[model samples]
Structure formats: structure tokens, C-alpha cells
Target chain A: MNQDKMGKGEQSRARLLQAAAVQFAAVGYHRTRVSDIVRQAGLTQAAFYLYFPSKESLYQELMDGFFQKLWELSDAGGKVTPLARHEVRDRMKENLLELFRFFARMPEQTRIVLTGAEEREELHRKLTSIVSANLRKNQEAGHVRPELSVEVAAESMLAVVQRLTVRFLLSGERTAEQLAEDAAALLAKGILQADRTKEE
Target chain B: MNQDKMGKGEQSRARLLQAAAVQFAAVGYHRTRVSDIVRQAGLTQAAFYLYFPSKESLYQELMDGFFQKLWELSDAGGKVTPLARHEVRDRMKENLLELFRFFARMPEQTRIVLTGAEEREELHRKLTSIVSANLRKNQEAGHVRPELSVEVAAESMLAVVQRLTVRFLLSGERTAEQLAEDAAALLAKGILQADRTKEE
Candidate 1:
């Protein structure tokens, strides 16, 4: 109950979480055991239980934390439309850069998030719906293309972001800013030549 | 073996495969046991073993079959560059339609393919590299935009196709042809308005 004890408890919990993340990333969620986490953290089973009741709870906490951070980052960007096309693209690139940087800083967390765990489906659905809603708003405001299916476009865009994060950012092959810029370009103009389309 | 016995063996193997696919789809690959598959097929363990050495082998066979079918469908369309832009779009749409139809007919197989299993990483890598190589060739031929990173474009395109298939085609919300056309349009022109970009 004292301040020092509470601080120690918080430290212990953080250690356990870090250990769990490492183990989960190395051996995967299904194979990772609570014992391994405790051992890696240099804590006893009692200490782990005091913090997380089970390995599943620990994993859930990790996922929840990541999703929370992601939502906050995206929400901080506010509405995406009502700006010029280039301005909107710049905002998208900035938001994605922040997101990729967050993921890149924690490759273990990135792996777990991208692993398609059953628990992640709910979060994925929520994120997709949020994006769909945003796109719908933008379409109504005449910012996005009118012909595009909001739902399909949201899902596809999220998929592209996730895949790029895993392939490039996680591997440290490219910086978050560079990947974000490329992704924004692709999402904005696609892979087709601009002049060629006009000529056609 | 005699022709009659071989024919029966083939029939039994096909039955087991169907049953395994059903069970795996219902309960997922990790939870579905060899016993459950055999029971569903109304066959013996000996028979299942006579065809697939293990459950992993059966799952691998299923994946291989899907990949083979997909490759054949794409290859049948031939090279994409020789055709005009419209023709290329049609070819891409038609190929995607066939692929979507394949997934629609067997949603269970689609679930397995999209589940991101460890065994699937190799197949995914192979598919991405093939797409990247094709994109590189197109860029060289001045068909694709030279500014785009072939690797990133390939991965993003594949991700979009997969997400669309799972969300639309697999769910039966849209016909394969409709989804393919919309997907092709998005892939070709992207999600942005044409004149808006020029104006900006």
C-alpha cells in the first residue's frame, strides 16, 4: 500500500509483460507457457499471479495496450477531409508514419498483432469499421472518390498498411517515414501512370 | 495394386480430403484431430494414413492444391503487358473473378489460407516474389509506374486482393465478378478522385 511498494509492484508487472512479449514472439502464443514468462522475468509464479492471473490474461493485456495506443494515435489525427488533396495525403502519411514508428519500436508486439490471433479479430473489426465510417464521411463531403465502396476500401487500406508494416518496418528495411510516404502514394494515386491514364 | 483397388483407394482418399477440409474449417487446423477427420469420413485411421502421412501433410496438400489452381488460373491469362490498358484490366478482373469463385465455393479453404499459419509463410513468400517480379517486368516495360517500389506494390496488391476476397467473396455478400471488377478498378485507378489530384 505504501508508495515504494506500489512502485516495486509496478516494476514487477512491467518485467512480466516484457518477458511474456518476448516469449510469445519467440515461440508463438499457443506454445508459450506462463512458467516460461515467469522464468524469463526472474519472478515467481506468485508474483506473476499477483499481476496477471494467467498467460491468456497477460497476452490480452498486451494486445489491449497496443490497440489502445493505435486508436489514440489515429484519433489524434482527427478528421481527414475538408483539406486539399495534397494536404489530405500529407496527413495520411504523417499518421501512418507515427503508426509504423510505434510498431517498429516494438517488433515483438508487431509480430503478435500481425499474427491473426482469434482475440485480434474483434479489434480488427472495430478498426475497420472506424475507417469505413471515416471514408463514408469523406465520400459524403466529396473528398474521397464517390464510386468506391467504403467498406471494401477501408478493409483493403488497413490490409495494405498492416502488410507493409510487417514486411518492411518490422524487418528494419525502411524507415517509418519512407514506408508511410510510399504507402500514401500508392493509396492516393495507385501504381498506374497518371499521364498514361489521361491519354488513354 | 490392381486397377479396381487403386480406384477405390483414390475414392477413399478423396472422401478423407473432403472430410478433413470440413473438420478443419469447422474447428480450425490446430484443434482438428486425425481421429475427428477419420470419423467424419467414416473411414479408418489406416485408410487416412494410406493417403496422408499426417494431418500436417493433409493440410499441406490442401494448400498446394489451392495454390496450383490459382497459379493455373493466372497463367492461363498469359502476360499482362501486351494488351491495352482496358484489356489488361479485363484480364485481371477475369482472373480475380475465377479466383474469388474458387474461394466462394469453399469458404472453409479460404479461412485456412487466410489464417496465417507458419506453414503458409513459404507459400506467401513465393507468391509475393512472383508478384514483385511481374511488377518489376511491367515497370521495365513502361506498363507500371516506374516510381513505385515493385516489392511494396506487389505485397500491397496481394494484401488488398486477399482482404477483399475474405470480406466480400467468401462472405457471399457480393458475386465474384462484381467484386473482381471493383477490385480491378481500385487497383488500376486507386481510391482517389482523378481530376482532384490534378487540380491540387
Candidate 2:
């Protein structure tokens, strides 16, 4: 049936995207070819164009999907319960750790998304939307300091996590889980040492 | 006459490296070519190979120089004058801003060094050396906590600034100075609402 054919096409498209993500991230965008991506996906070269208009457009989609997923995950079941500060911190930590675990689990995908850049303003704007929207939500919840611009706070936090993960993955010095937990603790603890037993 | 020839060669080599850094960072490592680098430096392709064996090796040198400069500049001079806790935070802020500004001034060089892979393990060892050495200096003067592992702290700080710089540059949003200043404040304050004023 026509409907059955459409379903098969969608499945093929998804598989192609998955394969492309790995190849692009591992070797980079410029180095990868349409034939190579289709070969990895066990599909013909024609299958690629059936899904993506061009390599550039596919890259744009990959990046768009990446940040969109992150935003969804972060925003899902979100906002700390107005519990004790430590409790809120624990919840925040758990959410962040989940994100890192996702990265560690699918590092190839993470690399692809983070390093992937296309010469398109529209895609960058989408990425910015994902980041800025999360910032606004956090601001509304009063989870972050109101004094700081939501944009700065959100972007800065993202920058920290991105670099930290890159170091952990590339350097192989620390476990991803440990880095995520420690980062949360530090960010929650503030800069100056407190009377709390935990050393600042 | 031999000495004059050597001096000219050294100057030619310097020019090539500088040109390569600009092109590599802007166009990325893969996109840059030996021909373009030579042309940019107003020299001959033969002259480029005379100093560097290949583009990759030239990139390696550029990376090495970057790490070496970071080491030389990581010095804190002295601890914050225990007047106000905010003063300590402010001083820390200033240091990060200065460092980020230093990197931003040479964005091309920054990109080449930052956008490399795990094959460069020797470079990691070198960079970590700079970090640990600086921390040890801070510890010796009673500025850094002896209990804290200098390696993690150093890497953590580096990650924050580097990641933030990437976002700042790639997004074309924040001015380099604004990003540097804001990122410094964020790093110094860590990300908590806790009263750092008590440290004063």
C-alpha cells in the first residue's frame, strides 16, 4: 500500500541520519561523502537524497535535532521542587548527570552535534533558540540568580558542560559521571568556602 | 653572510607560521593549504617546507606555541588581599577575563589548537603540565587549597573559558571583551546564590 511504502521510507531515512551522524562526527563534515554515508547505512546513494536535499542540509538537520533533544530532555519534568537547597541541588545534579550519561553513551552523536557547523544562519538561530528558551524557563523558576542575564547564565552553563565533557572524553582522565556530579556540586556550592562540612 | 641567510630564513619561517595560524583558524585545518599559507605570507612554497615539513607539522608547532604561551601567562602574581570576599571573587574574575582576552585576540590560533583529536596525547601531557605547574605555584604560596587536586581544578577552569569562547565566537553574539568579563565573573562566582560576602 502507499502508507506502507511511506513507513518504509521513513525508517530508511532515520537509519541514514544515524549513520551520517557517526561518520560526520568521526571524520568531520568536509571529509564525509554521500556514498560513504549510504554505504554505512546499508542503503543506496539515492536513498540519501530521498531524505536530505544535500549534505549541508543534512548537517543542519543533525545539529537542529541535537539541541532540540537536549532542550526537550532538560525541560521535561523540569523545575526543582522548592525543597531544601541541597535537595534541589540533588535534583539538578541528577538531571545534569542524566544528560552526561546520554553523552557518554552516544559519544559519536555528541561529537557530531557539538563540532558540526554549517554555513547557515537559520540552523544557528534554531540552536540559539533551544539554548535561550531553556534559559528563560530556568529564570522564570527562579532557579538561577536574577541578577545575571538569562542568556549569559544559560550559555555559560552550556559552555562549561560542553568543554568538561570534551576533556573527559578526549583526555580519558575522568569518568563522565564523576565530572557531571562534581560540576553540579561546585556550581551549587558557590565560590567562597562555607561552614558546611564539604570543603569549598 | 651565512648568518644573514640564517636570519632571513628564520624571518620567512615566522611569517609562514603566522599566516598558517590565521588561515587554519579561519578556514579550519583541513581547508588550509600550503600554497595559500605561502601566498599569504608573501613567500614561496619552497620556503614554507624549508621551515616546516608539512601543513600538519606546522599545525603541531602552532599548537605547541599556544600551550607554551598559556603556561607563561597562567601566573596569578599574588593572592587577593583579604579585604572583601567580593574582592577575591573580583580578582579571580579579572584573571579569567585577561586570559580569555589573550585567546580571543588570536581566534584563529585558538580554533586550530582547540579543534584537534586524541592522537595528540603528547600535547595533552604538555598542557596538563602547564596547569599543574601553575597550581603548584599557587599552593606553595598558600593561595590554593592543598587538598584539592590541581589537575582537575586547572582543567575545569580551562574547560569553562575555552567552551565559552567557542560559543562566543561561533555564535557571533557576545563581543570578546564582554564574554571574557562575564565568563570571568561566572567562573569566580561558580554559579551559586550563596553569600560570598561572608568571605570578606
Candidate 3:
């Protein structure tokens, strides 16, 4: 595609994703129609198809962006000085803190990712991959337990983070700061991998 | 209600619940209509209202059954002995293993509980109460750390369990026995508790 067309495509797609996130989160995926998203984006209804072929695609894009940002946090930690294996968890904790802080501000994606859309096999599969990769990376760095399976560890830990974030959004009880702090503790202690016990 | 009528009512309700679970798991809460449930249950559609005012009520009843069984497990453990804290967890593990094994065999409620319905406000509230009560019981028994806020501990721990269970359901990778054992270790090690350095 030409650069101009590519740029336009990206812009419209971004607007649709942003609009979808709001509508889907507020009214839910089943309730949010193409017309609603177009109206929210202030774009033509047919134009949404120009960006996303369907609602599920739009949801995938939204999740793609959300996870891309989360993955970036882990990558950003690479710039920090390397600590010993145990000490490296502090860096991971910082990454978790940043991720939780970012999530608190965007409960729309947070809700869907944690609970709503995870029911969809496609979305759940994509999320599983994202989690598995991150866990492997942390394991490779020696910051996480090698004895534990990264795939299970990743899914397990993501479940904890996702659940806590959803509750934060739902109950309106926890502040972003509090969530970040709690997430830090969850990571530092390896809440999912504690005891390095047998996989269950 | 008369005994005969009550017995019939209970039988009808059980069948209704079974039909609802299958439909809800298959099509999801929003998509699964009450007509579909009654049809699946081989009953008149209007009769559903007699048992459940709404489809949501059926779901509520299902959840109530789940919570009641969990408490029963705790009660059984209480009858045995209190001196062996680890035994409580062991029996708890056995209870959960049976529960989750049944869960695995049953169609799919992991998603229904987390993401099936739109908003799931009432469901979350029920879950929160069940979790809160369980945490309080453990604290009173001195099995859980009294210093930690019951609300936070309960919700967080529930989140952890729910997340892992969903992952297990979606991935179909982890064995139930392994999950129960790992959870036992995690609980024993105080991973879900407030602090690691200090005694509970």
C-alpha cells in the first residue's frame, strides 16, 4: 500500500479501535453495533468496515494494542542495570507496577481482557500467547522460577492481575496507586509460582 | 408448599438449572434466550417463570449451589479436626479437586461466571460475599493472617483462583490434580497472605 493510504488506513483504524473500546466496555461487545462505533468515532458507518472487517476484528485490534503496550513495559525494563537473579524481580515488579497503573486508567480494555471477551476462543488464545511469551522471557532472565512452566505461570499470574484490575474497576474501591503497589507485591512474591511446587 | 409439590418443584428446578447451564455455556448469557432454555428442558416456556423469574435468577441459583457446596466442604473439614491446619488445606484441596474435576466435565461455566453475562454485577456481588465470608472464616480459625484486611485478601485470593481456573479451562493443559497440589503449596507457603517475612 502507498504511504498516504497506509497512513489514512492506520488513522481510521485507530479511531475505530478507540471508539470500540469505549462502546464495547460501556455497553459490552454484544450490545455495541457498528453504527454505535461509527457515531462515537464521528466517522461514517461504512468507514468502519474500511478499517475492521467485523466487530471481532476490531476487538482483536484493541486487544493487540493493549497487549503491545503491556509488552513494551517489560521490554522497557531491559534498559535498567542487571541485578542478581533474586534482585532482578525488583525490576519485574516495576514493570508490573507500570502495567497495572496503565490498566487502571483503561478499564475498558481491562474488563474485556480480564473477563468479558476472554470467553471468545480467539481472544483467549491470543492472550495466552502473550502471557506465555512474557513468562518465558522472565524465566530466561532468571528473575522467575525455572522449575515452573512459563505457560502455566504466565496464565496463572495474568489471571491474578486481570482479576484484581477488574475488581478495581468494578467496586471502585482501589486506587491506581494501590493496585500498582499490590501488583508489585504479587510479582515480588511470585504469587503464582510460590513454593516452586509441582505443577497443578 | 406440600411435600409432593415441593419435591416436584425441586426436580423441575434442577432440570431447569441443567438446561440453563448447557444453553448459557453454549450461546452465552446475552445470546441464550429463556425460550431456548425451556425448549432444551422439554417444558412449556411460561413454566420457566414459575421457577425462575428471569434467566438471571437461574444463574443466581446455580451460583448459590456452588457457594453452598464450598461451605459444606469447609464444614466437613471442621468436623474432622482443627489442630492440623495443613489438613484443612489438604481436605480443601480434595474438595476443590472434586469441584474442579466436575467443572471440567461440565460444559463451561468458567467463562459464564467471569464473562458470560453482560456486566455480571449481581454475580460479582455474590462471588464477593462468598469470598468475603470464606476469608472471614479462615481468619477466625487463625488459618489466614489476621493482620491482612479480609476484604483485600478474600477478593485477591478469589481472583487468583478464578484466573487460574479460567486459564486451565481455556488451555486444557494443566491437570486438575496438579493445580490442586500447587494451590495447596501456595496456600501453605502464605503466598496469598499479606507479608512473607513475618509470622501470621
Candidate 4:
């Protein structure tokens, strides 16, 4: 039964991934070994070798899955029809809340993603570029401020979300909803006093 | 003379640190070996051991130097007398510009600090806490918006600076002066439009 064997193989791969995520989160990528992953998954070395040729490949797979999900969410956010200037803030806040919720569901994966793995830098670049493009689009639409550099703004926003998610949301300090709301508010209004005169 | 020998020993130590920074920046902390450092420094294993007991200790010294410099700059900024409300933004920009200049002088060290090395996370936490304390002080003085959480704002600001520094400043795409001015503006006015009606 070829189909039956394929199903079993998929289950084995899933188990290995779960174990790898836990190990990588706890001890970090460089310190984690295939043996540790197999032991945690209650699988044999032979099984691991069947699924992943090397620990690096397994780590790549984990990172790939993480980025794939993130891109999917970003795509979904992008497809939302352009909203009124007043409504864009709410939509952006909701999208960010969803993104944080995704991170909350797998904080270990979040840790691995934020660990500055060399391979993942490519993903980071892609994500920032995508955010920059989106910001440029919003700027063209007169939704965002036109003076700021889209590239820098996107990078800054990514940095803000990443830092907050890793430091607060992962630690359970506040719910994703709260963080998203507050972050959105801060990004929307900034930290400066509204009535203050703009000075160089 | 004893003093002559001591000077030679100090010179050897400096050479080793310089070589180690190059190695760590090119490859990463995990892959780098003491042998490579010693060879790069044009020194012997015996000489390396005479100055530092191990590779870990050498790395620790590098990190210590980096953080000490950062703390000094932060302290200098903190000592600046509370400026007029309109002048605070310019002073903050000037302070950040100085910091970016510091990073520019040693991009290798910047890479090391941002590489998320396990030990360096402690330093990152300390930096964030210090920033948070300062934000709270400003908030109390009514210089900053009171609605935002000082802790989150501090973390976000650090994240923005870190990302921009690593991506742009390290690559020579923008000068510290330009980045500081733009980042200060964004943080002051935010990405949102100024005339928008407040909506949740």
C-alpha cells in the first residue's frame, strides 16, 4: 500500500519536526544535534536519516516552514482591499494582531527565527523588502507619511515587531491582542507629543 | 627590563584581539578556533595562552569592550542637561548619531553584538532596561507621550536602531548623520498622517 506508507512517513516527519523545534529552542541551533532530536522524538537514528540527510537540512526545513507561514500571512494582509485613510489603521492593527497570534502559537519557532541564523538572513531580507514595497504602495496612496524612507520605515517596523514579540509576547507578559493594539497605536501616533512644535 | 616585557605582552594581546575580531566577523563565533586566531595574530599558542586562557575568555573580552564603550556613550547622553522640549529631539538625534559613529568604527564588533550570541543576550537585556528607565524619566517630565508604555517604546526604539545600523550603516548606504536625523523624525512624528481623526 504505497499510500499507507506515505501517510506513515508524513507522520514520522511531523514528529521529528516537533522534537527539533523543542530542542532548537531550548539549546539553540549550533548546540543541537541530530541525536538529541531523534531521542526527543522517540525515533531511531535510521528514521531521522530517512527524513533528513543532515541536521542542517532539518534546521533548514524548520526555518522554511516558519518563513512560509509568515509570507502567507503577509500575502493575505496585502490582498485586503485598500481602505479609507481613517480605516487603514484599524486594518493594519488587526493584521498585526493576527501576526502576533501566529507567533504566540509557536514561541519556540519564534525563538529560532529570531536567533540570527545565517541562512534565515535571506528570509529577513525578503520580508523587509516586501514590507518596504507595501509601505511604498501605501505612501503612493497617500495613506502613510510621504517624507519617511519606505525602506528604513519597513526595517524599523519589522525591528519593532520582532523585538516586542520575542521580549514580551513570548514571555506571556501581555496577550498578542494587547501588544498589537499598543504597537499599532505607537506606530500610528508616535511617542512624541502631538501639540509640540516640530523642530530640527 | 620588567616594564619592557610588560609592554610587549600588552602589544601581543592587542594583536590577538584584532585578529580574533576579523575571524569572528568573517566566519562566526562558533566556527572560529583559537588556532586560527593565534595564526592570524602571528603569535604562538604559548603566547595566546599567556594572555587569555581560552577562546571563550577572548570572546568575553571583546564583548566587554563593546558594551563598555556603549555604556560610556549612553552615560554621556544621560548627563546632557534636560533640554528645552523643542530641543530634546535634536539632542536625541545627536546622541544616536554619535552611537552610530561608534558602530561605524567597528562594524565587526557590531556584527558580534547583533549575532545573538547566548552571552550577549544578557547585555542586550541590560541595554533595553537602561533605555526603558530613561524613557520613563522623560515620560514623567511630560517630554514624551504619556499614553505609550515606556518599556515597549524603549524596546522598539532599540530594535529600530539595531536593524538600521546593521542593514544600512554597516553597508555604507547611509551616514550616521542622515540615519539619525531621519530616525529621529520618524520616532517623533511616526508613519501616520498628522491630521487623521483618532480612531480605534
Clashes of 1: 0
lDDT of every model, 2 decimals: 0.75, 0.65, 0.64, 0.78
Q: Per-prediction DockQ scores?
A: 0.47, 0.28, 0.33, 0.45
Q: Highest TM-score among the candidates is held by which one?
A: 1
Backbone-clash count (model 2):
1
lDDT of 2 by residue, B77-115 (tens): 244432343455556666666777777776767676665
Model 4: clashing residue pairs? Answer: none
The model with the greater lDDT, 3 or 4, is: 4
DockQ ranking, best first: 1, 4, 3, 2
lDDT of 1 by residue, A1-200 (tens): 34366688898998898899988877788888888999999999999999887888988888787878877765633467665544665677787788888988778887876764744677688888787888787777655677778788788878998899888887888889888877877886542113333322
Estimate how well candidate 3 is docked, as a DockQ score. Answer: 0.33
| Superposition error at A32 for model 3 (Å) | 4.5
Per-residue lDDT tens digits of candidate 2, residues A151-199? 6655555655666677675456777677767666555443212224332
Tell me each candidate's TM-score: 0.79, 0.62, 0.64, 0.77
Q: Where does model 4 exceed 4 Å of error?
A: A1-17, A27-66, A76-81, A116-119, A190-200, B1-17, B28-35, B42-65, B75-81, B116-118, B190-200
In angstroms, the error of model 4 at A196 is: 15
lDDT of 3: 0.64
Give stretches of model 1 more than 4 Å off.
A1-14, A28-31, A43-65, A75-78, A190-200, B1-14, B28-35, B42-65, B74-78, B116-118, B190-200
When sorted by TM-score, best at the front, the candidate numbers are: 1, 4, 3, 2
Instruction: Report lDDT (Cα) of residue A25, candidate 1.
Output: 77
lDDT computed for candidate 1 = 0.75
